[model samples]
Target: MTLAKSSELGITHLPDHTELPESDGTFVKNFQEHPQSLLLTDSITDVLQQLHPDHQFAIGQDCGIYWRLTEPPEKGAEAPDWFYVPNVPPMLNGKFRRSYVLWQEYVAPLIVLEFVSGDGSEERDKTPLTGKFWVYEQAIRVPFYGIYEFSKASVEVYHLVDGKYQLLPANERGHYSIPPMGVELGIWQGQYKNMTAPWLRWWDTQGNLLLSSDEKSQQLTSQLEEVSSQLEQEQEKAERLAEKLRQMGIDPDQL
Candidate 1:
């Protein structure tokens, strides 16, 4: 799986998403990863929609981001567990992207999050070319990188500053603020999809937890029920007043 040879063709050439290998044949490291990715994507979907009214945004869950050309095409790509790239259409050329080819898109993701499955060494590695941290900060130049560890119930975010990554300090709510997105990233201990544990989640800058589609639906249903109950109570009170007027020999309907 080699890239097209520019020299043999006598013209500079770069492969697009369609030509890239979407996977490296590696198994998912843990069971928690899939759900964690979904939770993050689900919770932030509304925010992304609001941010990109034109619907020009992409959210990749365990999808490869091709950064370079290598012998095995997959080697050049790093598939963050979860990532968000703004201003790019969710699909490419009327087709969903098989993978994000940086050479073609030329848009780095706004944020790349890696869920730490092992000792967290790979996520934090700084070795040139091969390390995740180096690939993100030095090559891809992603503005924000998050390393989340569910076992530790913790997350550490780094903001690319002056060609280096700076550890962002958590605010009063113990959440890292991504000002550009108008949201904060943090860990919340709760049940999502019936799995109870510390899950990485998002919040607004005002420290409000961003609800997922399911959570929002539940909230709306509860509010509607409460409103219906109050309306019924008011109707009963009106009937009771009419009865009192009738007992006093007053024409309640005419009044």
Candidate 2:
């Protein structure tokens, strides 16, 4: 389906490129208490980059998503913990994107992820016209909305159906399928970025875990070591056979 342009959506006059607020000072935050949020975001971005080497997609971490061009940044924006916009250049013009302005981009995010911090009410707030859930569901109408609570080690996925968000049930492996991304979202228990905890991770449609760069490197290293060890054992067995043949009064190299 063709998405409506900003002018078609009642935003007749596009704001001057220079007048758009790129950074509303919302990107900067103290992550000491919630460092996992950064780790999860970075890991997902890295994995997707590996998964789709040729595609250029925008992945934002704690960056403002300005849904309305007519409204000011303060009233029209929401900064998700992580968001993915497919088929878009990671940069705007030639510079890094400071904020995702929906009207200018003409594409809403395919999926938005909110890592539950503090009391977790803000992530699930459903107050109309004000709540994060409401904005993503009604205003932006994102396809998939995920709420991950690290404290409970749970993930809640909501799919937009009939202009409302419907909770989705996990599959047999306890993952929510995200068709647009061609991956599944699930909680993984492991150490990432040196922190041992449950992390929201992505899996292939076949249920294979998508690894970060470091994890991929480690996996390759492990496979190489296993092959080397098998080679060494074979070499030792060949030497043993040669020694036994020599003891039997025959030149081992003749055959």
Candidate 3:
């Protein structure tokens, strides 16, 4: 479908050039109350943070988006699995957060990704308040919406264009990219944290898989060590050659 006019859509895309939360405690509490639901919910937070590193994301977090309903939901809401209000800070309070508290930030996440907890991901990956065909298009108004099924290793990505959510075309690798985030999202078939099966992983600007913070650090360290060792070996070889030349009564320094 043809994209809507800029005036009609009212979306101002931010340039990419311009651009951690401890959920263990809350998980335990919410787990006792609703174990299965909490897992999916917590997973959303992790994924959202990874997917959209440029924006502040929160799970069970109320958004400051314009709610056409008579009034916004509760101030401190335990709402959806994950939601992002763009143009917000990247830090989180040490303790629990009551809803997203959008007023304080005056922004919301541009994208939100939710995971299916149970009962067929098709069912769990729905937002009735939002239209069926275009849920994020109508209700959440997030630029991009991603729904994932942990068990099935299924995923769907949607982008906001012409004031509507447009399904992103996947490549051979079953991947999609977001202009705002300057990254791509795809199903990675492998193990993560001991879990087998495909899991979501981040990619760098060059499309290289972005290793976890620890992995990246270790890789750089190893590279440095390798270079250092090579340099040492080269120096030793040069010294030996020069010593041999000197022993032969040759002016090694001149040579």
Candidate 4:
């Protein structure tokens, strides 16, 4: 089924940004208790910012996404663990975004990521018109939807094809490439934020893993230390050669 635009769907009245409700109090109860979820979300946002230093984008974690065609703007909304809407200002009216209103922005999220918490049922729910899966697939029509299982270190990506969410095949490196964002999503087993576990991470188009701020610092420090050590080795070798020449009755400094 081809998805209908807001105009075709009889959503003639678009609410202004000020008319939309920022918070519906749905994300108040331990919304993001999992530490990995927070880490992964922050890591993705950081890497994206570093990659596109000039691009403007809005990223939200546990932030309500207000999307409705005919009903009130805030009637039903989904708060994905992480969502990205490119080309939109990160803030609205010089203020940090409290939520994303589709009609007001006139752009749906390009990518939405959900980190599986309790049972994987909700993340995979496909009930028509009411389920989160249906809302993203049919209502909001997000381009890419990703479900990540932290415990199993698995990632499932779905691309919107013909108005339906279709599972995408992974590349050789077991990552799903997001063409619009020029990045790939995959699981990496490593230490982040002092916690060692399998974490979801982003990679560049060339499959280079995006490093967090701390990781980048560590890599640069390592490179500098290696250069310093190599210089010391070269200096010692030159001194030894000069000493041998001097012992053979040649003034190495004058030569």
Write model 3 residue lDDT over 53-103, tens digit each, in one string: 775554443222322211122211223444555444455445444334333
Please give the lDDT score for candidate 1.
0.91
* Error of model 3, residue 237, in angstroms: 1.5
Scored by TM-score, the top model is 1
Clashing pairs in 2: none
The TM-scores of all predictions, comma-separated, are 0.91, 0.84, 0.59, 0.84
Model 1 TM-score relative to the real fold: 0.91
Per lDDT, the best of the predicted structures is 1
- Clash totals for all candidate models: 0, 0, 6, 0
Question: Which regions of candidate 1 deviate over 4 angstroms?
Answer: 1-12
Model 1: which residue pairs collide? none
How far off is residue 5 in model 4, in Å? 17
Clash list (residue pairs), candidate 4:
none
User: Which is superior by TM-score, 2 or 4?
Assistant: 2
Regions of model 2 farther than 4 Å from truth: 1-54, 69-72
Residue 243 in candidate 2, Cα distance off native in Å: 0.6
TM-score ranking from best to worst? 1, 2, 4, 3
The local lDDT score (0 to 100) that residue 106 gets in candidate 1 is 85
User: Residue 50 CA error for candidate 3 (Å)?
Assistant: 15
lDDT digits (tens) for residues 11-82 of candidate 1? 456778988888999886688998888888898888888999999999998899998787677888999999
